[model samples]
Target: MFTLKIITANGNEVIHAAQDPIFHQASNTITFQGYDNLSNSVTLGEGLTSAGGDVAYLMGASGATLATWRYRQPVQCGSSLQPMDC
Candidate 1:
């Protein structure tokens, strides 16, 4: 099972969860850390995002899938609240 936990800065447990992957690819590697350089600044589980990669030994993917759901990058809003459009 997949597990997620949110901890307080002082080392307290704020939240936790268990989940399962919709898909898995064995013998696959994640070559890229994110969609693009802009992805570097974006945090996981925040805002619109894209992720996939093929590397040496590690292969992992998160977020919704086409079979279960669909997603689109939002338009740029040019505001501090959201740094990028999507």
Candidate 2:
């Protein structure tokens, strides 16, 4: 099963919020979807990354990984929600 939990807090480290792990789908590289939304889908048989922030993970589900969306970040920063555009 997929589980995603986001944790947002203030700058003073007082408003702490618990978070959960997520995944990334890579074809050959273990990185985030910087400009590719298609590489961010939390589906089965996909690649993932968790190198920074220590807030995410990539794990197969039932050996098939087909569940709810656990983690997702916008590929396009100031543009449309496309799969290959940033």
Best candidate according to TM-score: 1
RMSD of each: 15.9, 13.8
Output the worst ten-in-a-row residue range by lDDT, candidate 1: 23-32
lDDT of each: 0.24, 0.29
Model 1 misplaced stretches (Cα beyond 4 Å): 20-80, 83-86
Please report, as a residue range, the 10-residue window in candidate 2 with the lowest summed lDDT.
9-18
Which whole-number lDDT from 0 to 100 does residue 42 have in model 2?
25
Candidate 1 lDDT over 20-64, as tens digits, reads 322222211111223322211111222222332111111223532
Model 2's number of clashes is 0
lDDT of 2 by residue, 1-86 (tens): 23232221211111111123333422211333322233342232222444212222333434443333322343664656533335
Which residue pairs does candidate 2 place in steric collision? none
The per-prediction tally of clashing pairs is: 9, 0
Candidate number with greatest lDDT? 2
